[model samples]
Target: MAEDAIVVDESLGSETLLDLRSLSVTYQTDQGPVPAVRGVDLTVRRGEVVGVAGESGCGKSTLASTVLRLQPATATVTGEVLVSGADVITMRWGELRALRWAGASIVFQGALHALNPVQSVGAQIGEPIRIHEPGIEDSEVTARISELLQQVGLSPSRAAMYPHQLSGGQRQRVMIAMALACRPALIVADEPTTALDVMVQAQVLGVLEKLVKDLDVGMMIISHDLSVLASSCDRIVVMYAGRVVEEGPAHAVFDRALHPYTAALSAAFPRVGDPAARFAPAGLAGDPPDPTSRPPGCSFAPRCPLAIEACREAEPELREIEPGRWAACIRVGEP
Candidate 1:
């Protein structure tokens, strides 16, 4: 049977910005080869927001790293990472360097650490512009810096401030501006809202949301928080133990998840002002199986409350249970 395609509207933007085909990554550790991602296929159009949700160790970050060839030397990657129909894995050093900011960019998870403490935010944002467009005039670079800062909701004056001088949210916005500085077709944001207050998180998200709508830039946001993804993304892909477990429209995945792992994740977040959520929120027990020694059957079976004897026999392939909705579970649609 054909694989289920992610529901996309051609009118939104038919141009494919990022496409991953059967992509897998395994890290060569001192102990053994640890599989971080397994046979994951994803696509991001020119003007869309796709959210990747999963707990730590589920390969969410690894997937994001692979997009820009940012994975470490110890990691072995297989399959294609197509950025605008160009394969990143096979590109030469010169071509890869050129592709980093012009073809795609990344908003790293840690804003303070990612930015250089010594340089001003404006200089940092201008670095990519200068490197990618050496012929650009000084006046144009300054103007572009101010424009990007404004686009991310920061005052142009804030450009003079150092990383430590800005608040957490402001630093994140600066990172976003840096990502947009090159005007790349695709942006991969790995946990863009980490360690901020709920209100600040909303503001950061608002900046990203507005950028997507106004600039028509394709974005793939990776986070462990399902609620954040549910509120911001058009579509959500839920990962578990290095493989995608469920994927569908954001609202449907949050409200009516098909896989047990997705359901557990949805239940883990407490709803604001809801008494039941505050006091009786669901808790998922057990850690993900060790990647180097994963079981033969389902990686989630031992932790799943609905696991059956048959679940221990073989891993389930991701299949479409309904139009445009897919899940990897033998017991999907069962009452």
Candidate 2:
């Protein structure tokens, strides 16, 4: 069944589990400060999965990594990253180490590389407990590790096996179990199901969805796959050239997208009921502008189908088109 996404109307509660305000990230290259993400805002409520979809190099991964402060020193980041009311950027090394896993956890894109290949899966999952819950006994830790493995649909006994001993899907399951080990209030999964077989991806997504429900944890599921986000998230934010182009409830965004970029992205994806029908993705023509050399006015103006001279000279704010739906394009109400 396709889950209808929730639209945020003016009356909708502003209470957020994770809040990102006017966030921007700039990389210091030989060319100078290169902005990867600009003036982006996102809010994920408790127990909801918010999907961030964008093309490669469109800052989806950078945005997710910023929430964890995982980027390198060269990246100049300015913004308020509030998780449960504490600003993540201001936290010191000790505070950050303590806050992570306890406050939020991450399931990185490459589970195989994320896991310690030589270590038993059990140890990797238990590492969080050992660090954060040092007060607990070894017997208690063992019991918790077994329960976590079971929670992610892996056999409890499999924990004793090494990463190489499990299939790709099983490794991903271990990663999810590790993220949930400390019962984190929030989780950031960066293309978590990537490189898995279809059946395995479905299984892993199912486990993640179930965990979000059972644990009441907020989540940010970042990917380029439209259907995956549509099926898994409560809301969707579409990005292009490091800026938000469109955003709304997942169902509404798919059913009646308001932005040209949104329409183009949907056309690129194979429809669920008509998978056999080939979809010739309308690839966005021309390469993305160099980050250090982004054009004035609308960043996507050059690629927009309905762009005009005004679009090239005027920056468009992401505004509500209809209730919860928002688009950064100047032209609206078109097919």
Pairs of residues at least 3 apart in sequence or in different chains that clash in candidate 2: none
**Predicted structure 2: lDDT:** 0.85
Off by over 4 Å in 2: 1-15, 275-281
Q: List model 1 lDDT by residue over 96-143, tens digit each.
A: 999998889999987999999999999999999999998999999999
Per-prediction tally of clashes: 0, 0
Across 256-311, the per-residue lDDT of candidate 2 in tens digits comes to 77888778777677776765535454566776677888899888778788898988
List lDDT for all candidates, in order: 0.91, 0.85
Model 2: how far is 294 from its true place, Å?
1.1
- Which of the numbered candidates is closest to the native, going by highest TM-score? 1
Q: All predictions: root-mean-square deviation over Cα?
A: 3.1, 2.4
